[model samples]
Target: MNATIILVGTELLSGMTIDTNSIYMAEELNKYGIEIKYKFTVGDNIKDIVEVIEFGKDKSDLVILSGGLG
Candidate 1:
């Protein structure tokens, strides 16, 4: 199955922080025979997040979003 990873945080896009979660998730998912086909980083903007989520959902069997759930 294909997966899409979206890291959502303004700090991430601003280069204030490096994203390690996606890398870890990708590696772990690969062990389960899941392929991550696309990765994206979006800021705190709702529109951009929504757009990426829609795209991820449409293109991948599973979509994983990390960071800023609250």
Candidate 2:
């Protein structure tokens, strides 16, 4: 299956914090034969996060979001 990954964090956009979750998840998913069609780094905005997820949903079979929980 194909998937899209959305990494949400203001720190990510500002480069203050490095994102390792997406990379790790990507590797694990790859081992299962899941192809990642898109990877997006969005700031900690609810609207932006939802927008990306909606876009990914339309373009891929699965949309996975990580971070921005604080």
Candidate 3:
């Protein structure tokens, strides 16, 4: 299956924090024969999150969102 990974966090966009989560998830998904079609890093904005998810759904069979949840 094709997948899109969306990492949400201001620190990620600012480059203050490394996006280790995406790399880890990608590796794990790869084991399952899942192809990562797209990867996006956006700040903590609901609008941006919604937009990316909407876009990802059209391009991928699965959408994986991580981080930015408190």
Candidate 4:
């Protein structure tokens, strides 16, 4: 399986907080034989999130998002 991970939140883009979720997820997915094609860091913008998801749609069989809600 191929996957893409989208990190949401302006803090990620601004470097306010360090993200470790992707690292863990990558390791877990790797063990399952899932190839991670792209890791996208997006600010707290709906348009940008959708755009990133759209881009990943063609490249990945699975798309995942992490970080900051509300």
Q: If the candidates were sorted by their lDDT against the true structure, best first, what order would they fall in? A: 1, 3, 2, 4
Q: Give the per-residue lDDT digits (tens) of candidate 2, residues 1-70.
A: 9999999889898888888898899999999999999999999788998999999999999999899543
Output the number of the TM-score-best candidate.
1
Give lDDT: candidate 4, residue 62.
Answer: 98
Residue pairs clashing, model 4: none
lDDT of 1 by residue, 1-70 (tens): 9999999999998888888899899999999999999999999999999999999999999999999633
| Better by TM-score, candidate 4 or 2 | 4
* TM-score of model 2 (CA atoms): 0.92
The digit string of per-residue lDDT tens for model 4 on 17-66 reads 88888999999999999999999999989999999999999889999999
TM-score for every candidate vs. truth? Answer: 0.94, 0.92, 0.93, 0.93
Candidate 4 off by > 4 Å: none
Residue-level error in angstroms, candidate 4, position 19 = 1.0
Cα error of candidate 4 at position 46, Å: 0.7
TM-score of 3: 0.93
Instruction: Give the clash count for each candidate.
Output: 0, 0, 0, 0
Kindly report which residue stretches of model 1 are placed more than 4 angstroms away from their true locations once superposed. none
Please provide, for model 3 over 1-70, each residue's C-alpha lDDT reduced to its tens digit, 9 standing for 90 to 100.
9999999999888878888888999999999999999999989999999999999999999999999533
Lowest lDDT block of 10, candidate 3: 61-70
Q: How far in Å is the alpha carbon of 64 misplaced in model 1?
A: 0.3
